[model samples]
Target: MFQNLSERLEGALKVIKGKHKITEINVAEAVKDVRKALVEADVNYKIAKEITERIKEKALGQKILIAVEPYQLMIKIVEDELAQLMGGQKADLMLTGSPAVVLMAGLQGSGKTTFSAKLANQIKRQGRQVLLVACDVYRPAAIEQLKTLALQIGVDVYSEPENNNPVAIAQNAIQYAKANHKNVVIVDTAGRLAVDEEMMNEIEKIKKAINPCEILFVVDSMTGQDAVNTAKAFNERLDFTGVVLTKLDGDTRGGAALSIRAVVEKPIKFIGTSEKIDGIDVFHPDRMARRILNMGDVVGLVEKAQQAFDEKEAERLNKKLRQNQFDFNDFLSQIQQIKKMGNIKDLMSMVPGMSKMMKDVDIPEDAFKSTEAIIFSMTPKERENPQLLISGNGSGSRRKRIALGSGTSIQEVNALVKQFEEMRKVIKKINAMQNTGKKLGKIFGR
Candidate 1:
């Protein structure tokens, strides 16, 4: 996820670490390194050169500031340029009309189908009645895959499996949506291995028949420069309103994301961050630049937390913490919510300075599996009253039983109980500090 590019850029910007001013000599050296880094990251050589030139020009034109370091200023300059290259601002989907139609277009294996379901899920979460239309008549079981995804996301689907006519399927889907009162229609069209006259003509015909509000071209970011070329062809034909980059979580060089918008003259509206249905994110260039520069995306992290954590459940947990009643039940519920927040390591990397610190650390995806299993093995009473297993009366026997039931060692069970108790104690300490703060406010009488 741009990790290599970030590390290389950081190294390039380090040229001005000890300098007090942004001199032309230092700027040239930095820009050269930056250009090399971008080229190595699969960026178009011309675009990379052009961007580095702009960065150099900006760096030389800026005055030395007393409040900011030269290296920090260089980073800011590069971040701004990168963001501008990737569509200076976020572009939102135009979901207007009684049943706003969005046509999906891209080459095969570009994740067009998956992104369609993801888009529908996103709109459905926004309080809209979304109908996912399956028009990929050539791909075997493409309609079934879409139906499965729609079912998982609790969205409706309109498909004519027997009818191989995608153009008619899309038109009928819109008519079906209008009759069913669905406010949004996402037509997933068939894609070819390579752009051809037949494939292009079919999608164009579907576009003409549907009269969609938004036409999104989904591309596989892992495809590198090929993705950009494919996007250019699609844009030339369909003139898509926006772009969607999928497989961004893979080991991609990120050239597609950096070059597609500039090449096609379209904004990147969405990015698939993970394989989960909820992994789709509205593209934000500024936040992306921050992440690439090791600045971290705090706002994005907060948004993910807000979406994953239930407000009512959090309020209840706060009350319990204040009362020192934070039990295993609440702990289990918290774990479930955190698991829904997507990849653990990716979530941690969103915090400031954590990405660099955890670069070499291997955080397993199943890190919480053992803990969850142990807790699930516990009886309802044991979960409600963790004290029952921690008390000195029969602690050892109870732990052994838990270890056996959970298929874990006794030492692991003991360690989990100890960690849980420590967490409860920390909550108690926080509650005490809050109480002390209130008492001091009363005493000060200010």
Candidate 2:
């Protein structure tokens, strides 16, 4: 995420904190800081300058409005500018044809194959039959990887490994999809390490051969400016209809995401986070702008939660929490839900103030592994009633066996069980306090 850019912009706005109004001098300092922050974030210098200029003009024009505080106004200004810079509106994939042929283009390792499977899963979720076509003839393993992903996601993959010509393979894949009544065909083409004439020519030929409805250029956001340059090169050759920004879960400076649209004039249709099939999110400029301002993207967060939420399971867990009966089982279940939500770093960064407050901290991706180990070590009954193990020191012979079973040391299991017991006690106390406070509030209201 753009954690660095977010922090810097927050600092820049602080320069005009508590001001009752916007002045040219104050706005100039803040805008300069914003430009500098963007530049430091690896954003194109020209794009950064152009954005700040637009922001300043908007702020100055709105100076007469006294409704919002200076800081609030500044945030609003930045949000609008950011949204405008990214794209004022989200773009949709052109899926008009009976088999909406999507052509994927990028340099090698830009995540084309993974994105095709993800998109297939997405369209399948929409109740459309999707056929993931493997046109990466150059890499023998790519088709296999795509097939595995398709199977995991419950989507069909069309591959002709014996065919060396990608254009022919793509054409055959579409024919197979049509024959099978599949309505969506995602054609994954081969990519070179860099934009080569041969690769470009092949992709362009495949595009013409398939007559695709959408040609999506996949770019690795981790590559920053290089990603933007690659998009430009690809767009010049392929004239892609949309962009898929992959590896956005990484600590990308966000330069590519910021500059690609301005450079290539294409809407970013999707963003890829982890390798998981469910890790793709449709790009939204407004939500992204909100995130960049350290404001919690409640819309995006709820969408993520809804996607991750299991209604029956959440209701069961809520009952346990309300009854002060939450245990290691519930904790483990929650961890699974969180894992399904995609990269922990990217997820946490969406929470307002979490990324900033935890800047110096490191939360490993294997965050739940230790806890999972401890929980697995517990007996079925112990997981349900953790108090016994907690009160028994979790050091008995049975406890040691449980720990060994879960592949964790006895001490770590003990710590986990102890924390769970302590948490239950804390919840009970908080509930009692809240009940008493509610009574007092009612009396005061009366």
The most accurate candidate by lDDT is 1
Query: Candidate 2 overall Cα lDDT vs. reference?
Result: 0.85
In Å, residue 231's CA in model 2 sits off its true spot by: 2.2
- Which residue pairs come into collision in candidate 2? none
lDDT by residue (tens digit), candidate 1, 1-446: 88888889889888989898888899999999999989988898999999999999988898878999889889899999999999999998988888899999888888988999999888888899999999999999999999999999999889887899999999999899999999999999888644488888888899999899999998989999998888888888888899999988889888889988888889999999988898899999999989988899999999998999999999999899899999999999999999888888888888877888888888787889999999998989899999988885787888999999999999999999999998888999999999999999999997
TM-score of 1: 0.98
Full-model lDDT for every candidate: 0.90, 0.85
Worst 10 residues of 2 by lDDT: 390-399
Residue-wise lDDT of candidate 2 within 1-446, one digit each (tens)?
A: 78888889999999889998889999999999999999988899999999999989988888556677877898888998898889888998879797888888888888999888889988888899888888887776988898899889898888777888988888888889888999999888887644477777777789889999999999889989988888887888778899999988778889888888998899999999787778899999888888888886767877888888799999998778778898878888988998888777777778877767767778887888878877777778888887667665544776788778888888877777677778889988987898899999999999
